[model samples]
Target chain A: MVRQKVLLIKVGELKDLFRKLFVVILFLTAFLFIMLSRFDSVAIEALNKVVIKVTGPVMQVVELPARVIHHVWTYFYDISHIYAENQLLRDENKQMMILQNKVRTLEVENQLLSRLLNYVPPAEASFMSAQVVAESGDKFTHLLLIYVGNEAVKKGQIVMGDESVIGRIDTVSPPYAKVILITDINSKIPVVVERTRVRGILSGNNKDLPQLIFMRSTTDVQEGDIVVTSGVGGMFPAGLPIGFIGSINGNRVEVEPMADLSRVEYVRIVDYGLAPDAELSVDFVESEQNAR
Target chain B: MRDNWRENLKLFAVHRIPLIATLMMVFLFFMPINSVQINYFRPVVGIICVYYWSLTRGYIFGFFSAFLVGLIIDIYSSLPVGVNVMIMMLLVWTTDWLRKYFSMSSFGVNWLAFAIICTAFLLLKWAFLSLYFHHLLPLAGSGLGLLSTVMFYPLIAYINALIARKFLPQERIDE
Candidate 1:
């Protein structure tokens, strides 16, 4: 009986030792993967692509219930507010008619002035709309996966919500593209205050408000100033609405993104056709590496 | 022979319940909820599953299952590939070490232990992420995530326990 007990204890010890060793091996393997991903090798990219391609469909299927819930909720919400919305629309339409007449007069005046000055028009941007299929859904990162069906959606295309810029295409695999939101820590865009034309780099800190940095110390900026893309980097077109300055501490200024990023169901992917396909990717990779 | 084969298949399916359930939780974690209010309170469901299964049935829900769960999260999330893998592995290892003390304890005691471990897990994840980004990340979001996970622990634990009681063999569960 004592012999059997001793053998049992020995077997238990061996099992414990094996468990410890396995944990260590897993830890090491995880570390190796982190390093491999940091370097962003071809193998890792290919693996990521394959994983995304396989899981994209699965995510869509899983998202069906949530989609149904959202649609039903929206239907009820719209019904509850329909009367108020109709009244508000009627009031807005009256104002819009007056504004439209003024705009027509301004357009004719601007055309005559432009012909006199020989002014050149900016290149028109092309856009495609896609439904947002998935989101990162974690606090650690902000990203959206949009289903781009058979379209030639390229990297560095700007993704816009109903009224303003939301994010940009970070990676594109056919039938799906990953959008890095303006609120993500990794996002940086060159923007100018509309009233002041004070150019600065808007940096996301994974918060609701992204901070504007790199402006002149003497430059004037105030709360509630509208901010727009400066087209400095050629990635985003100039005069595209981003947000308004939400707050301005002595030097720290934060802009609240105009789009309700959390509620975005569809996005317009705009291509300005400025930079070559490889240039933006190269720049983004280099910047990431340099940040590391 | 066919009867024997069917019995073996049943056993195999029963044994895989914990891992399969945990993978489903991983998928549920990424389900797209459009509400800002709900999105802000999203819990770390994968960690809860790993902790519960490892504490209750480590022999069945082993390291490889934990590793696979983490890999799936890594693939689905925008974060770097191995961060979740490392987090899940550590969770399993930690829970395995403490299983003897808490395995037989009351649900409240188990929950208290998980709350502490989940905090540490979030800190470790934040540190790894901050290190990866070469900067310190804000901790408020993680704090909210922790709160949500801890608040929802009882529901998740109950669901897992039900699965364990229903599908897992009585001897394995008793162990």
Candidate 2:
């Protein structure tokens, strides 16, 4: 009798109490479902897919203004830079061609020496072109959704645009992948200067550029030097052009990336990983001498 | 159902006018954005709307609505993995909590609670991004922008409350 009376009293305060209690139960169930994955990757994946699908349209709605801005931006570019910029570009191209020849010649020499020294060449990266589906971020974390390409790109894969490194894949759905840009404060990479071959740490500053920190003051790096993946830690492939140093201080350097991140429409994600027995082939001196 | 339809129609007419007015304001604000680096935050509209729905119909606007709103914010802003989802979930939950003491009828008290939640949210987002990136992202530039977000909050809350009072259900003198 007392138990019945307590139940009746408790039930009276909550309107549609049983139904609300059921909803609360269902919500707890969903929370448990999310947390209870024990190497049960498939369920987690399906849940992520459901979340992505439900969220997709909403994201598109949010992107309307940015899309409009981009379209309007094109009109300004066409009108403003059509004539005068062509002449400027022509001059720039001529100088670039001259520099390009020198670079090609150096590359050939470097390749020959590497072969002579029995050093393994950098892995070739594959490019996948994609369209920007959306741009979403708050004050802290900014990310972009790229429509998945025909070529499969996975999480942690390096993504490049304009032959310069942009960032890497963060997550993937079947037809879309989220890319975390290098400018996020969380981004880090081991990089080496192409001009001076000075190896150091490269990390983003959450600004328009990233900074190379903790380099030896005597490090042989300079402004205008190209920064590429050192491949020292195996996060990225060597020889991938990431950015160019825009400023250099005593032990710190700032880089403006080669990829125009704002207008990145396509990117390449090369299938690259650490080589087997990379440590054993450290100098490759024994292999070279044996070959000789 | 019949009375509800009548109520909905009246609600729709009342709500439609301000919504259109707001949309017109947004359209005009967006139309001329060529080279100007204007600091218009698009995500605020959807957030304010979600808060409205959550307060009016908490049961109806559960996790999914909050999730959808966050995703929309992410889409407009270009964040990875809908990080706004996490933030919005917290915001919705907190507002729901504070609604116990302060509902829409409570006026300034409710708005004050909402302001604290929004501020806490901005700080939380900053904290998450910093923790993820492993460093502060130069907050003086970004931090000032955060404070400015507070300035817009009261205006956004006021506009949203005015719209909400017109639609859904208002506190009735007859009740």
- Which lDDT tens digits does candidate 1 get at residues A259-284? 98888888999877767243553464
Model 1: residues with Cα > 4 Å off, grouped in runs:
A1-25, A113-120, A276-292, B1-13, B173-175
Question: iRMS for all predictions?
Answer: 1.6, 6.8
Question: How well is each residue in B1-175 modelled by candidate 1, as lDDT tens digits?
Answer: 9998888888777878998898777676777677787888999889999999999888888788888888878766778888999999889889988988998999999999999999999999999999998999999877888999999999999999999888788785312
RMSD of each: 3.9, 8.1
B134 Cα displacement, candidate 1 (Å): 2.2
Which stretches of model 2 miss by more than 4 angstroms?
A1-49, A61-69, A96-124, A205-208, A211-225, A244-256, A260-292, B1-47, B56-59, B62-64, B67-90, B97-114, B125-138, B141-148, B151-175
Top DockQ prediction, candidate number: 1
Pairs with backbone N, CA or C atoms under 3 Å apart (clashes), candidate 1: none
Steric overlap count per candidate: 0, 15
Q: What is the TM-score of each candidate against the true structure?
A: 0.88, 0.66
The i-RMS of candidate 1 is: 1.6
> Tens-digit lDDT track for model 2 on A1-292?
9999999888876656765675466455444443433335455545555655665554456557767787798889788978998898999999999999999999999989998999976555555677667543344544567777445676777777778778777667756677777776546766788877886666767676788865545357768889898776556777789889988766668988887666665566656654322222223323433544
